[model samples]
Target: MRVLVVEDHAFFLLGLVTALTGHGHEVVTAGEPYQAEKLLGERRPDVAVVDIKLPPTHSDEGLRLAALLRSHEVPVLVLSQYAVPEYAISLLGADPRGRGYLLKERVAGVAQFMGALDRVAAGGTVIDTELAAMVTRAAARRAVLSPLSERELEILALVTEGLTDRGIAERLVISVHTVVTHVQSVFRKLDLPKTPADNRRVLAALAYLRNG
Candidate 1:
């Protein structure tokens, strides 16, 4: 696979490039947004690993670059130091496919970072569980989610982590039936429109995370 890494930090870029090369991936790099856009104009990589805060502004430049990469048909995985849910929401936008937001600490575990990149490359959503929680906690008392009780919010967070009813029940040490009850209430409070897909749980969680 061809991977594009857009990051301003030199040492981290060195380590990441070495890792991707060791894993048999071809790599292209850009230290900042302008250079990244120039590379994008020349060639689109299979996937892009971008930092949220980039040089010059050291703010959302990398994030905006990720969006541009996606516009160019390259999948993007945002690797950042901060767990800002709002950033994740903006990065995800309306379409979650081929988009991912993972905290930079995951890079310490090479396997985790690669796994997330692989998923994004395959056009899947990869929201970090920690970010999932921050997304909800940050939105607490905001619209849609304001009606949820504490337990419902907890269950919603677990849902965003990709846990099933049974999995959530096991982790929370509650009966599956109890977990289902909480989950049902969560969706009801959010008032999600009925859809044929079984991903209503995910939609409900995303709704809450984006609302508050």
Candidate 2:
């Protein structure tokens, strides 16, 4: 797999490049803001792993860049220093496929990090369980996620991990039909409207993570 890494920190960038290359992936790198754009124009990578902090107004530059890349239908996996639910909401926007938002600390878990990158590149949505816990807590505080049953919440968490219906069913040792029933119940309880893109699962999970 080919990956483009956009990170300003040299040490961390080197670590990422080294780790990804060692994982048998072709890695392209850019250390400066906007350099990723140039590389994107030059070569198409399966996925772009970006850091949320960058030079020249080090605030949300990477987030902005991720959004831009999504507009071109590119897959993006964003790494953030904090588990900010709002940031995840903003990054995912309407279309949640081919997107991911994970905590920067998770980079230490090489297997987990690589799995997330592969999932996003394959057109799946993956948010860190830690980040999702943060959002779930926030939503609970606001009483926005109270309507979901314990089982529904469990399924939502799995969905947030980018599991498909069959995967979720297998994980829970339940039938696919049961998983679908629970999923539909979740959407109804959340009042998530269906869209032509068939992204209701992502939308419902996003709503839970975003606190309604």
Candidate 3:
């Protein structure tokens, strides 16, 4: 797949580009958002892997780039050292599909990281498992209404990991119906009025992060 990478750290950027290229994927590298935007305007990419922080601003350049890609209907996978849940939510605000948020340290295994990129490029969300748990715990702490059960919280974490109900059920060795019920309970406890198909997950994630 044709991919674009936007990162500020020179070594990290070079390593990622080299790794991706070695994986047999066409890679384009950009040090900042402006260059990434220019590349996007010139040729649309199958996927964009962006760092949540960048040069000129070092604040939210990657977030902005994700928004730009979303507006253009391009897929995006965000990589960051910190579990900045707010930034992840923003990156996915435009379109929950074909998006991902992964912690940089989690990419230690090239095979795993490349698999995540492939999943995002094929229109799937792939949040890091560790970050998902962190966000879930944060949500539990900040929750105002009813509190989530430990089991419910676990299910929610799995949800943020981009697992389908069936996949979650299989992983947990529970029935699909049980998984669905737990998910519903989680939303209700969190006062997430929106349907699961909507962006309620984002709210839950943000709340979790805030509490943390």
Report the number of the highest-lDDT candidate. 2
Cα lDDT, model 1, residue 90 = 84
Report the candidate with higher lDDT, 1 versus 3: 1
Candidates ranked by lDDT, best first? 2, 1, 3
The digit string of per-residue lDDT tens for model 2 on 1-212 reads: 98989999999999999989989999999876578888888878889999999877899999899987887778999999998777887888877889898888788899978987887898888877877666666776788879988898888777766677877898899999999888788778877764323234665676656756
Tell me each candidate's TM-score: 0.76, 0.87, 0.81
Candidate order, TM-score descending = 2, 3, 1
Which residue pairs collide in model 2, if any? none
Lowest-sum lDDT 10-residue window in model 1: 194-203
- For model 3, what is the alpha-carbon lDDT of residue 144? 38
Error of 1 at 39 (Å): 1.6
Cα lDDT of model 3 by residue, 145-164, tens digit: 23667787788788788776
Candidate 1 vs candidate 3, TM-score winner: 3
